[model samples]
Structures are given as structure tokens and as C-alpha cells.
Target: MARQEPLVRAASAVRTVVEQGADDGYAGLEISGDRVLLWWKGAPPPAVTDTARAAGVAVEVRAAEHSREELRAAADRLWRSSGVEHGGQLQAVKIISDGRGLEAAVRPGRKSPLAPLPELGVPVDVVEQEPPTPTSRCDDGVPWYGGLAIRPSGEWGGACGGNENLRYTCTGGFGVHIGSTEYLLTAGHCATVGETLLDGAGQYIGEATLRHAEHDLVLVRTDAADRIWDGVPGVSDFTKPVVGWVWTFPGQSLCYSGATSGANCGYTVVKDEYTKFCYEGRCWSDLIAAKRKGRFSVAGGDSGGPVFSLINNSAWIQAAGTVTGTLQQTDLLGNKTEWVIFQDFGTATRDWPGLDTINYLDPM
Candidate 1:
């Protein structure tokens, strides 16, 4: 005969223990293979323990003062040692309460008192704290030459590929550096992978390290280089936008940029959507459609470019979402022809986490 499944035995044992409890006795039962766990509060009786023992079940109890980590470790050890293999995964762990277990008491730091858990009359174990927020860093800026500006750091290349002939490229955007090594942020998509992009002048300086991705941010590192100013037009103080930085909205001013477009400004038209522009690609975000008639708007090879809002005669630049264009309509002899119409469209920093990760201090 096949070996008996431990989970089935555990379930049966748990059912037996629950049946022996009085109407107001055992709070609940948790089963894991041949092991049965029961919860109770405000003083449990010996009869509950006796019933569990009769069913060949090991009892692991908890109290409010007990840490969650301690209880979890004990449960893990018990499951391993019981010789039971199936269904040992814990579903949930909760502290049983009778509605009057929380009492407020004041402490030192503030005006509010500390609220501790009241005595639950059960065994509680210590628990571990949640993980910390990830970070990345790049103290010095990257170098730029010709039309290509190389930053010494960037997040992992999630999906990076380019076509030289067509001049189109897409890099799963990564987190940008804000400050020291400890505080870094990046786009959520970039952080999914563990990698970075690097470029150095005379030496191989540093590499891009991904801290976390949920906010679409990454941190990179380099030599302890002081921040430098190139005094170029349109390059806002990385420390802060000039003043009055508003997101793209209807009738609001906007601009498009990239290594190719140079930098052209426009006005906003539409606001939000997964819009389809040139090349049949769809971009999703709060759309900032521009209404400026310029020689060149957004073009290929401009993903992850910065979009700026012109407010109070100052330029406040932020990462524009994605750049797209439209298809132009041409008329010929009672027929209409479709052609690629390149325009500027993008999302604003207000909709992304880029602005929150850094403090815009006066230019240093």
C-alpha cells in the first residue's frame, strides 16, 4: 500500500480536538499534516490540552508578548521533526483577542501614549521586522560626447536594444541617482533585474547597482566626484527646477527632449491614456499632448527623455513618460494617404516617483 499522507492525519486530528471544545473554549484550530495547532485566549483550560493529546497532536501555543519570528521558527522546527511532509505550509498566524486586550499608556518621545497589547493569557513569540527600502547611488555625473551622453551608472538593462539604421531604441527605464550610496530609487520595471550600465572617461570608475524597482528607480556609484556645472542652456539645476513645476495638464505648457530632438517646447492638449503614436507603439500614462508647430518634435531614440513644464519664466524639468508621434493624413485624387506624423507626447513627474526621491536644493 502507498505511504499514508501526513496531511490527512493532521486534518483528522485537528477535527477531533475542535469537537471536544466547549461552545466558548477553543478559538480555532490550524492543521498542517500530522500536526494540529489550536488557539485560545484569556486563560485556556487543561481539558483542551488533554483532548489534543488524545488525538496524537502536538500543541504549539502563543501569547501576546511572544514574537512572531520565534513562533514561526518553532513551527518550522516542529513540522520538520514530526516526520510529516505534506501540507506543512502555514496559512495564517493571528493573535486571538477578546476585544479588551489593548490598553493605551504614555511614553517619552511625544504627547501620545504607547498602546501595548493587554495580557492575552496565551504564549506569544517574537517576530522579525519587515525588510528595509532598497537604495542605489552615483555621486558624480556621467560624461557626454557628440550626441551620446554617458552616465557612469544606471539600473539593469531590462530590455535594451537599438537599431542603428532606424535610430530607434528602448531601455526598460531604471532608477536615477539622487544622493549618497544609501538613498537610491528607480523605476519598478528596471529593478526586476539585477544589473547596471556604466561609462567612464579615463578609467573604469563604478557600476550601477539596483536598490529597489517598485518606484522605477536605481542607484549607481562612482568616485567621490563633486557635482559640476556645464553652463549649457536648458539643463536645469539637477538640484531643483527653477520654480513652479506643474505636471502636464490641459492648456498647460510642455516640452519634449532627447539626444536627437535637441529640446523643443509646446503646449498641452490631451491629458491621460495609453496613446498610440508613430510606429504603431502604444504608451500608457497621463498624456501631455503638445500643440507647438516646430521643425522637429519627438522622434525615434527618445524613450526615457525628460519633459519639462515652463512656469514663472523658469524651466522645471522631469522625466517625461514616453515619446510618440501620429500618422499624417494626405489627400490625393479623392483618396487619403497615411504618413508618419511625429509629435511630442509624454507623462509628467507628478504621476511618477522621480520627484519624491530627491530634494531640489539650490544649485551647488
Candidate 2:
């Protein structure tokens, strides 16, 4: 398992330099194992190289044909022309990590192939696939911990219950404090604003006050604790207190706990700032992507669950992201693999200023 403290420092430091340095050639960055992969349109900048080296991790500077800005512009143009956002075959579009080109996801067996838009300045890598969803399949409570079952109040939802009552909705994420009010967190797609959230026992937990559909995040007004359920759900009971939160990075191993799927580990972070189109032109950027190290990591009711990294191999964890949804990728050999899509906490804080998890900096 990856430790949180060192990884947080390294990633935060590298990201700070990247944000401060207005290098146009800056393609992107990736934390591969213990080293940093710095991609650039030309040669990597010396300041960035020195910073990465100073972080006490190995550094690999890569060359790219196009800059990030150019690729983003190209992606926008592709979205406008490809009609992927307009309920077309295009599932998602993103600037590949290597910064060489853009990868466009299109539906398989569609009637018409996307036209060769020579107009796009960058090369477009097309992959036949389907788009991801909000993962609402539907979590718990007064200082409520995360990873427990929750759903729209008065609705028969979630993976719990017997017989026909097995309606799954979502899992509660980390609890946060915005100003003087405390609130629970979950995926925005799970429920609309004003819907009251309830536990399996039908106890009132909170009310959905804010929904950011574009970012796939929701804030429920209630009392929440800075802790998460790490147990096996009815089999074993264990909980972890969230010490802090960190940004997502490629190759970072993490885990998640869902109400339906329980808790599964051995997932590696795959991509950052990925832009995905769900349905009818609805799209969002800055979304994190991870590949399952095992057969499965999340399920239909896992939305809004906590994505976290272990702390020093102990039960303590650091919040990473909110479970958004999953996508299936088929290889040439007909083998299918699933990937987890989420909105990281870093993006959450950036979008909602002064927004932070309860006890975020409390001593572990």
C-alpha cells in the first residue's frame, strides 16, 4: 500500500511548481511509482526539472509534439464538431498524459463513423467504447462517517435489504464543513438538490443543498465526522479516521468502500483531469480515472463513496476522491476490464473555496 504523507508532499510540491510556471510547452505530469514523469512540448524546463529532482524522487523528462493548451483547444473543437456531447457516438475526449495527442472515445457499432476532421490541429486517437454514468444505484449519520449506505429518503434504493427491496443508490463520502455548517458528501448524480438523504434504517441523515452536476459532487447539510467505514459490512467492523486529503496522480495505488460492493483495494490511478461526456452533451473535466487491479473495485451503488489511500500501513486513511462511475474497456482479445472514474478532493476544494473535511488537520 502507498503511504499518504510522502506521496502528498511530492505531488503537492510538483503541482505547485507546475501551476506557478507559465510554461506553454508544459504538456502534463505523472507520478509513476517513486519518480515523476514530466511531459513537455520541447525540452523540460530547468525549474520544473530541479523541483522534481529536489522532491527526492527520480525524474524522467519526456518530449511531446503538442502543448497542453493546443490539445485542449483541439479537444474543444472536436467536441463541437464530433457531436459526441450532442448525444452522438463520442463518449469522452481528453489530452493523453503523454501530451502527444488526444484520445476520443466513440460508441461501438454506431451507424456512422466520425468524419476525419482534418481541421483539428492535433492527432485524434479514436477508441470504440461507451460513456460512464453518475453511478447512482444507491449511505449514514450526526457526525456520520463515510462509506456507509445512503439513499434518497423514502425511496427503496441501495444494495441492502432482502428480496425486491434490493434497490441500490450510493455510498456516503467524507464529511465536510463549509463555514459554520457541517455536511455529508456524495456524488451529485445520485440525487438532485433538496432531496433528503436517509440510511438503511430510514433515519434522516441530511438534506442535499448543493449539486455540482458538471463536477459530479454534492453537499448534504448535516453533521458528519472525519472518518470512514473500513469494515466488511456485516462481516467485520472497522473504521478509519480521515487524517487529511490529497490530489490524484497516475500510478497511485488506492482503495474504495461501497455500500453494495463493500471495500476493495489494489486500484491504481490512471489519468488526471480527464473530460468525459455522459449523456446529451453533459460533460465534465478534471475528473480522475483509475484502473482496477483486480476484477472489480466499485459497483452500481458505489457512487459518492470515499476513495482513499492508506496511512503508514495503518487503519488511518487520507481522502482522495469521490466515486463517480465506472467504464468497461474491451481489449483486442475480447477481454473486458473496468475503470473507476471520480472527482478528486483537490478539485473539490478548488471549486468550493474554504470547503474542507471535518478535522482535516487534526493530529492522527
Candidate 1 residue-wise lDDT, 230-258, digit = tens: 11212431322422122222233445443
Worst 10 residues of 1 by lDDT: 129-138
Off by over 4 Å in 2: 3-8, 20-23, 42-50, 137-139, 159-168, 271-273, 279-282, 329-336, 360-364
lDDT of each: 0.30, 0.74
> What does candidate 2 score on TM?
0.87
Cα lDDT of model 2 by residue, 1-364, tens digit: 5443565567667666776765668877777766667778876567777777787666677887888888888887777777555545677777776677888777776535566654787887777777675565112445688887787876777446232443446888888877988888888887789999887666788899988888889998988887888766556647788887776777777788777677777787875456655654567665778886336546677889999888756667888889988887666776767777888888888777878777645734
- Give per-residue lDDT, candidate 2, residue 222: 87
After best superposition, candidate 2 residue 224: deviation in angstroms? 1.0
lDDT score of residue 297 within candidate 2:
49
Given candidate 1, what's the lDDT at residue 97? Answer: 25
Give per-residue lDDT, candidate 2, residue 224: 88
Candidate topping TM-score? 2
The number of the candidate with the highest lDDT is: 2
